[model samples]
Target: METLLINEQFVSQFKYWREGQVRTGMRFRRNLFEYVSKFNHHQRHHAFDLAWKLAQAGKESIVTATSDSYTIWVNLRVVCPAALPSWSNSGLEVGAFEPASPGLVPLEAVLSA
Candidate 1:
């Protein structure tokens, strides 16, 4: 439901979360959610902030933002419609969420397993 207008800029910067990779969870890092969510305003504010922080810390961060994680957070945000301003568009026309009929029906909802 929550939409992440991952512009070409952000996508271009994210060279790590490419296709066909897997994360096994052998990490021992700080809690990204707590740190960044304290400031950002969006559904995945914590997740997104933490991901960026992890990247800065030089950990194998691309895994933090696998397609699965991205999707889960985005969906949750959409459902809850968090108070984070980052979740919405700015300048009166930010190219982020495209409002739909009530709930956001996932483009791949049928495939969710």
Candidate 2:
């Protein structure tokens, strides 16, 4: 089984996004980069790696930013599955849950176990 760890910074940023209070595009980009960088350097999760690649490629579908505003189309729960329960209970769009790898266990399964 795989263990997923959700850091305080990830939870804080996720709350900001969930509340639609990300403020400016610059802030959003900065937070995204910081989270992705930290995850890559420490955890090396595939979801975060994918996010980093997409961000570097300037994928508008995942994120778009301007001087005043920004939009994040990516579902951050992919990189932070530990937040899935909170997201689902809050009636937010949790999106689909698919394990990044066959060896990776789903959050629901882990919780149920």
Candidate 3:
């Protein structure tokens, strides 16, 4: 499993984006780049970069968004196990896995147990 932690700063920017879209008469965009910038920008972060890359490569991920933060967990083992160690070394915290929804066990949690 590869985890990406999006800090509160990003969430604020995301809310701004949503409001901007509404004001511009554009439907709220769901593009990954919109939420997490890939180019140089104030909202850019390493976590966003990794998440974007994984998403582009068609890796499966679960996203959990809250007012405090946004978290993404990529199931790299099924598609690219060798890449796991590199992601693990990227300074992301390894916290207790929290299921994206109630009563659902993330595969990583099950395997780790």
Candidate 4:
């Protein structure tokens, strides 16, 4: 699990995401998730970088992994001031398997997402 610290860059990302989500009527854009696999030290890094980006955008993102490492969960709490009244937190879960070797997770995947 990781927590993104709110800062100027984070605020900028947040604003951009929010602005893009606004529509003429009662519609919105879906959150983007551009993910890649990576290794942390020697372990498989199966977490999604979008969670951290969402956190930076004032959306609290919590990630959890089971003991067996077969499943992971992403829980999000969106509290942006520009959001609609009916908006609520979102969650996602994915199944994962251990890799034979390490993998690469790029920063570009997060920025471009």
- C-alpha lDDT of all candidate models, in order: 0.26, 0.30, 0.37, 0.29
Which one wins on lDDT?
3
Clashing pairs in 1: 1-78, 2-78, 41-84, 41-85, 42-84
**lDDT-superior candidate, 3 or 4:** 3
Candidate 4 per-residue lDDT, tens place, 13-113, comes to 12112333421111012232211112232232434354455555565443323333212111212334444322222322232233233443332343465
The residue-level lDDT of candidate 1 at 49 comes to 53
Which candidate model has the greater TM-score, 1 or 2? 1
Worst 10 residues of 4 by lDDT: 7-16
Over 4 Å off in model 3, which ranges? 1-44, 75-78, 94-113
Order of quality (TM-score): 3, 4, 1, 2
lDDT of 3 by residue, 1-113 (tens): 45344432332121112322310000111222222212223323554666766667776443434453444455423444355445432334434333233343333333343
Task: lDDT for model 2, please.
Answer: 0.30
* Candidate 2 C-alpha error for residue 75, in Å: 11
Minimum summed lDDT over a 10-residue window in model 2 is located at 33-42
Query: For model 1, what is the error of residue 9's alpha carbon versus the real structure, in angstroms, after optimal superposition?
Result: 24
Candidate 4, clashing residue pairs? none
Model 1 — which ten-residue stretch has the worst lDDT?
A: 27-36
TM-score per candidate, chains pooled: 0.22, 0.20, 0.36, 0.26
**Model 2 Cα lDDT, one tens digit per residue, 2-93:** 22233332322321232332311112333331122111232334334444554454432232322322223333334343432321212222
User: Which is the winner by TM-score between candidate 2 and candidate 3?
Assistant: 3
Tens-place lDDT per residue, model 1, 1-113, is 12233322232111111124221111112211111121123334545554454344343232223332331122221222233334322332213222223342322332241
Off by over 4 Å in 1: 1-42, 63-113
